[model samples]
Target: MRRLLGRDHDNRGFGSLQRGTEDAAKGQGDASETKGQSPIRHHGGKEINREQIHQQIGSLSELTITFLLDKPRILTDIQTEYRNVYSLSYLSDREFWTCSFNDNILNLCNLQGEILRSVQTKSKNWPYGIAVTQSGDLVYTDPRDCSINLVSGTQIQTLITLWGWTPLHPCGTSSGDLLVVMESVDNKNTKIVRYSGSTEKQSIQWDEQGKPLYTSLGNTKYLSENRNLDICVTDYAAHAVVVVSAAGKLRFRYTGPPSTLLESFSPLDITSDSLGNILVSDPYNDHIHIIDQDGHFFRYIYNCGLQCPWGLCVDSRDNLFVAENVSGKVKKIQYYK
Candidate 1:
């Protein structure tokens, strides 16, 4: 049962973000060096007007740069009825859907932890993964039936069912598609597949060298597509966060920061912020890792009273929601300014 994906930390201290500086251009130098004129910036060889200065960050054209707060604090904590909260997905800025590993019930709760609505899986089996679509509908994976189901109002519809594979994690992409991490019944093969409704669009299984990208040990891989369209997966058995380009090319793998206190890096749930920064929950260490899109270590969120942090998701405002398995509480953390 240890490898069957059902699994079961503390604390608060401030962790600072080690901000890195980036040059405007590779060798062209800063435009501000010419003291007599207003500060102008160049992006992709195009001149940026003074009015757009605040809107741009580094090479990102339209993205507004946001910095981490000196002290990331929990805004509020929402208590749930689940004995162990497993997964959660943001339905709106004020609402989210969550489910426990042992229960078939999925609850839609507001920021105050009020259960405004609840739905049970049609199969009456616990959902291995849950995601909310752009249309504000619930999509979940039922490993017990090897099916991907969607909840549209009061109707529960089966989207897809597999014969030999069991879907574990489902993430709704920006392009209105779905990405799922699945494992063979024998647990000898693991892969991620993208689906356009019920039709399979892409499969990400092997690396450039043809080696398996994810561990076949268990169905514990949780994934999120970043703002830059990169698919980020936290492979618990691998003890690494594997990120790949939108085209399925390997980008990088982050295996925790150097000199960590935990015996092993156990990354469960993953999410990406507005800045394309990948946030992963390290429940074994009682912290969350904040890394840049390029896999650079940014900092750690350790002082936010996290214990057995499992599922993670960022709201539209970039505020983080962490599901603490042991406490049965979901903490809303404001990390960025």
Candidate 2:
């Protein structure tokens, strides 16, 4: 296995880089996985080569974290180290899931980022963007399938079939519902809608003036709500994080100060930590920004070698899991005091 991040690694241009996401169906490991470990696993006596992971180390800068960063869990046992999980989503209190680029769903050991066990997928396309409900059910969007599906109790079922359409992305809520941000009509009509298993529920696309919220940009994605009864989302076209009250009232906005780093970032996913610190994905810039509750730039975590981090989620322990679009790999960054 290769190291995901190392000081000696320099991201040479495209010709020298390896696409980190391997074929999930064939799988790249002989590690016996349990729930909460890595998404890739051992199959019958065969092993998949995951050695290409560390060689393409992308160049990223260090962020000034306000709070201390959590210690990364190191897997000593070679058979359970989940080094290539592409998505991090919790299905229950003691169980979470990770998937590889080729849709190998596995029960994972999250705190240390390990793989527990895996159930292969029927559909072989690469899977990303996972949304697990409160009741140990999983829902996710597959770019290849052009739809969202549910995975629970070893059964995979299609819930929503979307083609030629989808907003920024979909996220799971506390009530087992999905809050989806989608791009529509030439990217001019961006909206967030709640889905009760694919059925449309409450919506939050209108502003105070009742204008439909939309952006004509290719980089529109990600939505989240704060504990303080406010909704915060990223608007890549506007180059700002849009904030509104739960009742649709405009609260405030946060944008990084002007700089080359601040330019052309397609903000994807967002989450609010227990400290009321808001972290949003700036995938285009290969970093996640931690903003204060007052919407001020605090710091950037995992700043380099990130190629369009999408599918962002934070667990109960506040570990940030980011999905890298190009690499098709999900990396976990533990946050602590």
Candidate 3:
């Protein structure tokens, strides 16, 4: 398989050069896939041509087909007017929800950075995490009150309240379930819990070795459910991205890519694209890491003038909205063609 990034590879004006080949290969692979046939043949040790090689590569998985732009540019910079945008969730392509640190107000803003509406937490406390549901409702976690709250239209309701754990990040899954990352009040235990409404359906905390899957310290862990139903979390204390299967079994952990920056790998926010690619924000390194579902490091997205890129969420069309903590600007970046 061709490597997504190479040491000597130049990043300028390369998208158009590869698009034609990849698109053609994808079409061939899709046709062969529907018929349940292999694109490669073993006929007396025959050598495959370039076209056959492309088809064989494409047959691997559609999720691996990424139409990434050679030079990803920022579509617009939305001056959110917050002290610092700590969390971002897309309610729609034109509207999103943003909240600042230790702030009790959640502002719904358009692409032009106009505050269309605002909602306060049920307890008038800051929300640790925010997410948009499939039904276009807003869900957030209030650690001060140890509850998960839902905002529908003009009403705010407490959906789930914990006894000994404090919810840090709440992610709304496509199946209408919620994935919340919570830590024990004592700060000694951390786990990801799946909730169907207010009821606990599953918990993912221990690995196959009966050890904690995430570090016990740190409130920067954020999560997202991939297109393949895999749960991805960025463990700030652990300095790694931990992924698990839908059954809550540990799959793999990505520490960081090779030739990292001087600062340690400190991942804060996490999200997944429509192609099942995982995107992680590394504020310390001033870039975003794009990895495959199986934990392969593909490339880095840092050229769009990102400064302290903290909160990340992709829109319905896969356009990335990056909330820069220092600049207080929500940059709409088109990473893919």
Q: What is the C-alpha RMSD of each candidate to the true structure, in Å?
A: 14.2, 14.0, 15.5
Per-residue alpha-carbon lDDT of candidate 1 for residues 1-337, written as tens digits (9 for 90 to 100) = 0366322100010000000001111111200011011111100011235344434545332232346775688998889877567788887778888987567899999988889999999998878888877667788888877788888899888878787777888887777778889887766888888877677768999999999989986566899988778999999879899999889999999998877665577788899876677889877667788888888777788776677777888876778999877667999999876
Q: Compared to the true structure, candidate 3 yields what TM-score?
A: 0.81
Candidate 2 versus truth, CA RMSD in Å, comes to: 14.0
- Per-residue error for 160 in candidate 3, Å, reads 1.2
Worst 10 residues of 1 by lDDT: 9-18
Poorest lDDT segment (10 consecutive residues) of candidate 2: 37-46
Clashing pairs in model 3?
none
lDDT of 2 by residue, 173-229 (tens): 545557666544233455676666556666777767887554544433556656554
TM-score of each: 0.83, 0.62, 0.81
Per-residue alpha-carbon lDDT of model 3 for 1-337, expressed as tens digits? Answer: 1211122222121223134223432443300001111111100111224345446666212424446776788998899878557688877789989997657899999999999999999889777788876667788877766777788899887777677777788887767777889877666788998876666778999999899999875556889888767999988778899999999899999998877654678788898886677899887567898888788887789877787788898876778899977667899999877
**Residue 264 alpha-carbon offset, candidate 3, angstroms:** 1.2
Order candidates by TM-score, high to low: 1, 3, 2
